[model samples]
Target chain A: MKADPKGVLTGEHYLDGDFACAEGALAAGCRFFAGYPITPSTEVAERFSERIPEVGGIFIQMEDEMASMNAILGASWGGVKTMTSTSGPGFSLMMENIGLGAMMEVPCVVVNVQRGGPSTGLPTMVGQADMMQARWGSHGDYEIIALSPNSPQECFYVAIEAFNLAEKYRVPVFIMMDECVGHMTEKVIIPPAEEIELYPRRLTNSPPAEYLPYMPEDDLVPSMIIAGQGYKIHTTGLTHDERGYPVMTAEAQEKLVHRLINKIRLNADHIIHIEEEDTEGAEVVVVSYGISSRVALAAIDEARAAGIRVGRLRLITVWPFPEKRIRELAPKVKAFVVPEINYGQMVLEVERCAAGQAKTILVSHGGGDVHNPQDILEAIKESIK
Target chain B: MEQSRTEIKITGFGGQGVILAAYIIGKAAALFDKKEATLTQSFGPEARGGACSAQMVISNSKVLYPYVKRPQILVCLSQEAYNKFEPELISGGLLIIEKDLVKPKPAENGIQLLAIPATRIAEELGRRMVLNIVTVGFFTAVADVVGEEAVRGAIKDSVPKGTEDLNLKAFERGFQYGKNLREHGE
Candidate 1:
């Protein structure tokens, strides 16, 4: 489906990543935004507040991240495309409800413009420390989709993809943008409304009386009905049956929990997006995501100049990771070098996927600025050795 | 001079619009000149008048790393900025500074120093607010990193809607100064 013309900003714009992200959400038909302002990530919320009014949408400044999370879920349940954005600390607070959103199968987009942190470590700096947190912070055996963008342009594009994925799977989607990408300014060309594609909200064709809220179709995703649509619906954080009623039994739990995980794991091929370059005949491959991917390229270039056959695998969709590709490449490449802003997160995934078939080397940073290209270059050289 | 990549740093006090100067240059290159540019800035704690800077990388290919570790062109609008960032300039780098604000020691070997009275020129333009635009104009003429028409178009697109004429005038004043400097071989 084409984007709503009212929400589209059709032009070439010089925009920062945060503002671009907001534009992408609008263009994706996100009509409801509830967020609490936090540094680095606040620009996303601020832009939404400013632009939402013009598009005849709604932007709510919630009291906290927890409320913001719940509000987006509520808005989604009301049949509106919804989103919220926050940083590391706020993201931590939103985890509980993010799990709620996951359990209830709420379709919403959450943007994390990551910063240096265990807790508010550096509000105004870059970090990719939230990768693992985005996957597991919400405490449960549930799955979510997350996309990492390297630049403002990707931030714009990935945001739209996030919303689309959220609708497709009936789950919360994450745009894992770093502080650098959020604050950095670049040119973004927003396509015309007709050119921009959108995934419309999957509404139930089943009549109000016959509609079952949690009934799954062949795709394992259930169609949604708006709260005021005269359908009797019930959704909670607890395990529920097709009728959306809590059934306190292991059988119900098994059915519900299994579907929650498999919906994403089974569709991994369709959900995963990676950019691979020169992997053929490569002795070493550098695995990276978000801003780290761009920084790693400099090192990759330097390694190439030194006559090393190094390839690059950039993870655009960090979650539902391209595990199959890594497994395929592990035996071909001598080693895989993973670099990220965190001490070590996604490297663990690379290590798991490589599975001792090849040497897995991690170049970890505590996160303030980006890795020096020379440092990554050294790691690539060492990996080949 | 036209390498695969060029890194630029624009530094000054917060109110001097150092970030805007970088933004305009980036837009000029990326949007108008069709080169790839990425710009990142330092968001210090202080609100106004504190140390402010923006880093940009322009490349024929995509800019892999966004931050400018070693700036090829360092434009300093304040003395403090010059002192703090001067050490990071490459040996053969071009140093552009505000003549009245920064009192440099001597020009080092392989370093080309060009000074402009951007703030004074802006004051003559009837508003000190356009000082950054003037600096942008001078930088365009002196550096040749982006075309004159591209920078002018970027300035028109960036500044406030009604103030385009004022900003363009500021840009022209500094651009003329820079052109004269090049012609005189100063």
Candidate 2:
């Protein structure tokens, strides 16, 4: 219930950027957090270190992000909610394991509070350049559920959703939050501990001898059996048969790959999230997410006051790229503007969705500064005309 | 078109509470008064002694974007901030400076100026910690961004356990200090 939230608001209690992320994870029922602290993202590890104990959970500061991700995979298999957070450079290092999680059908959340980068570009400055990489960073053909939260409150709920989607589909999820949002302070009211609807991992109850880790049945997500729970489970990155034995045959590979992709793809409607604003008859629609979307929404209201028919399509879940929704909204909206911290990263997806039905323009910025609303309002003015 | 939004920027050297000032003032306007406010900070490498700025947008409706290109209200806590931000304010906007740290500049045509003893007033309060809240008090006094009650609410909401007494006293003194500044010639 909506308690007074008297002493429970941890971010309100005083935390640096990294600790805010950790508290969000803990509040999201994250039973396991594993990672090595670098410079800026270290507080996340420290906070998780302190928090995991209180909830009867475990926190492990692994040797690296790869091990961190693998440990989370292991823990999630042990039937616990799992997550690991890293910065841009660490995120790059964890790419292979992210692929592993994708192939192994393991549900775990990974957060990248991004700093500047081609490689360790700026460990402290904020950057949204990782927008594209969050979707295609790991090698493979699989859909992802990447959420970008503009503030700490959204960060809390999005972490839960990241974990929820991960378990529901058995895949790795990304929290594509910038460092600014990670560190910023605000009056975020944490709902009472009882109000949280936390989704723990789904465990298999099949007999020990007959357990097949990859056996496809009713739900495309094959039930996962804990490693040491008296279950003979064989899991691998290579294509496996129903008995969980690695098979080099193309037929076995197709069935496995298709199941993995469709498990998420078939549920695209349920996974996609878009926050709409006064879009009924909008002529100019700005598609922005993360902290940048905060400005986009303000710009829309400002333009509307000036008699501009503006609206906003704020992506809460960016990866499954609200394609059908965008197409439906595109026919009615005359123009689409994407204002991101990076230059035209997400607009590419919006353009693909628009497909000439609507004019797509990029209101982009870079090097840590979010795009200003006036630039977007100017774009709206030009687009509507 | 009726303007319903106001974008302000607070820029200063490290440890000046630029970020905290933005939060208190923005929260004062948005959350407490039921308007919309968005707060953002510049990414700092030094984390100490480097130039830092906080951008805040205070509006009557929903705040979509938060970053500022041209500030309508620019408060400079150091000369570096003054030099960096003076050119960025829209012509005829308001500029406030710390008298001890920055030399006062008169408005050309559209811009207005204020010279405040914010650092001295905060120091006189027996806590140099209140400097950011002092600046926030000055912002409310000049721009009517939000009421004093809202600032207090923001303060209470932003401060953590055990530090409430210090922050609350700091905020009240800062509010009075700004009032005293406005009442006097400076």
Top-scoring candidate (DockQ): 1
Q: Estimate each model's TM-score.
A: 0.97, 0.84
Residue pairs in steric clash, candidate 2? A294-B64, A294-B65, A295-B64, A295-B65, A296-B64, A297-B64, A298-B63, A298-B64, B92-B110, B92-B111
Winner by lDDT: 1
lDDT for each residue of candidate 2 in B33-108, tens digit (9 for 90 to 100): 8766767666546646766788877777654554677989999999878887888899888887877899756678
Question: On residues A178-287, what C-alpha lDDT tens digit does candidate 2 reach at each position?
Answer: 87777665445556666666555567778887777887657687778777778877788877888778999989878888888888778888888779877778888888
Best by the TM-score measure: 1
**Residue A37: error of model 2 in Å?**
4.5
- Residue-level lDDT of model 1, residues B1-186, one tens digit each, is 124899999999988988889999999999999998899998848526866789999988887888988999999999889998999999999999999999997989699999999999999989999999999999999998999999999999988899999999999999999999999966
The whole-model C-alpha lDDT of candidate 2 against the native structure comes to 0.77
